[model samples]
Target: MSYRFVTPIPKRAATGSVAAVYSASARELGALFAPHLSPAPDLHAALWAVLRESMLAGTAPRARKEAVAAAVAVVNRCPFCVDAHAAMLHATGSHDTADAITRGEAPDPLVAWARSTRSAAPDPWPFPAAHVPEYVGTALANHFINRMVDALRPGSLLPGGVLRAPSRRAAGLALARTVRRTITPGESLALLEPGAGPAPAWAGDGPVATAWPAFERAARAGGALLGPTARAAVLEAVAGWRGEHPELGGWPGSVLGAVPEDERPGARLALLAALAPYRLTESAVAAWRSSVGPRGDAELVRVLGFGAFTAVSRLADRVAVVA
Candidate 1:
């Protein structure tokens, strides 16, 4: 089945601090996936940019946004996200507040009342009738899942699940796979290389040439905006490399090594994948299937995707509120 994907918006620059933050986030995220597969870093980076753009343009509070994210992770059973968000709460000195809520404890009167309201647990000992909207709870659940997705499978943020989701669990697994692939053996070596220079002739000239454009096109279709110069350079570099290495089927560590450190992470990789010429590589496809294998429920996958979307929407809203 052909999957629908969002193309990157054609723009000159990312432009704002939030946008830059999002880009950096994408890069870091991509680094997480670089080791496992050929296309993961690119996918992760592209999704990060798309989600950040959406959030910066929306109206939500960051704290509430994080709470919602926490809720989703709890429901999804994603330990990584739960621990990470809990740490975030702790850093903000809200550990007591969050922990109280999570453990079903007898919190101090004032805090207990608030936790009861937030968790929507029926009042055991009533003080005042405090009502929490069903939607609020729903939003929290959704937010949690979305954040997990953002952290784990940024690529799935693209409009359609074309490259990633064959089913809901498959989608989640696809995201997990993307995360796995972002960190690779070559990143350290790439970082140690002298002055950020263009890729070696052997690195560029090969099957990488054909694959790069396909990847780039996918990224553009998925909402990553690339400047003219950046786009042109990528195209030229990939083309030259493809001409040199006709046997290459997947991207090499050196290709990433060649990228300037500033541009070498998730966002750049996503941009490269979106603009490259190949479909999800065989390794990526296989890994995605394996990751989601244990959780066979498609509904869970849909919930995860929807949760991610909601979290991002909320984050966008919060950023707007402060701006």
Candidate 2:
């Protein structure tokens, strides 16, 4: 079964940080997942580092973080991420919570807060102040990843899209042992450059604080693929957003009118990725690919990843660590 919109590096060909992250991720997810992001090794490493530190390696219960990941994926309308995370949530023995969440019910305050993180005013951080980094960081990471999955590969992480409960439970069972393993914090930080960027104040002092900024730095590097006009257009649009779902009509197109004709495709694609990734379509990708000529898939992944993280950062900035 194929997994990406573009060609992926054969696992054997992965080297350096990419190889290391893939090996680490496979221990939990059971395969060399995220092949599309592998083409840009730094971005892949940074993303995995953030995800590992925040989701898989924190003092906060991994179940709560998995709930956050699943909620965030639901907000983005990413079925693929929802399935993956919900299964992990189940693996953590929160079967009732997992079932409630998959049914679109918020089973607890943490789950409710996770669902609200994309709003202009998210519910007061539901956990202790100390947990802000882990909880919020997990949400931000999924916010970034859900968009990448939506734009690049919009389907089940499971084989043949078999999302039945039996399959989901089987997956949960496969991951149960690894889900309970203790991962040391900050181990993934070795993959990041020192002082790549400042951690968010809301993150407090923790490995998540360190990892989130580094991932942002690596992901934002993709914005360089856009021309000045196109890049500015994406930033401006994202800045003005207020957590509302875009009106899938003429909205993004209306905003891109002032951008240069040649730059619209990239700008449009970026805007959709940041604000309404569910609206992204094949034609939208085709337009960007055609305008940019024969650039490789890594460039495209970078641009979309940049747009995704831009929104993730914007929303994450608004999250307050209420005691």
TM-score of each: 0.28, 0.93
lDDT of 1 at 317: 32
Candidate 1 local lDDT, 94-209, one digit each (tens): 55644543344534443333233223232232221111221122233233333333333344222233421123223333334322322221221211213323321212232222
| Candidate 1 ranges with C-alpha deviation above 4 Å | 1-23, 26-42, 50-59, 104-323
RMSD to the true structure for each prediction, in A, is 21.0, 2.0
Task: Name the runs in model 2 displaced over 4 angstroms.
Answer: 158-163, 321-323
Model 2 C-alpha lDDT per residue in residues 1-323, reported as the tens digit of each score: 36445677777888888888888888855566577788788888888887888788878898889988998888777888888887887788888887788778888898898888888888887788777778877888888888887777777766543345556677888889988888888888888888877777866788877777778888898898888899998998888888888995798988888899999888887888898877788788888899989988788788888888889878876775444
Residue 79 alpha-carbon offset, candidate 2, angstroms:
0.3
Residue 242, candidate 2: alpha-carbon lDDT: 84
Alpha-carbon shift of residue 131 in model 1 (angstroms): 20
| Top candidate (lDDT) | 2
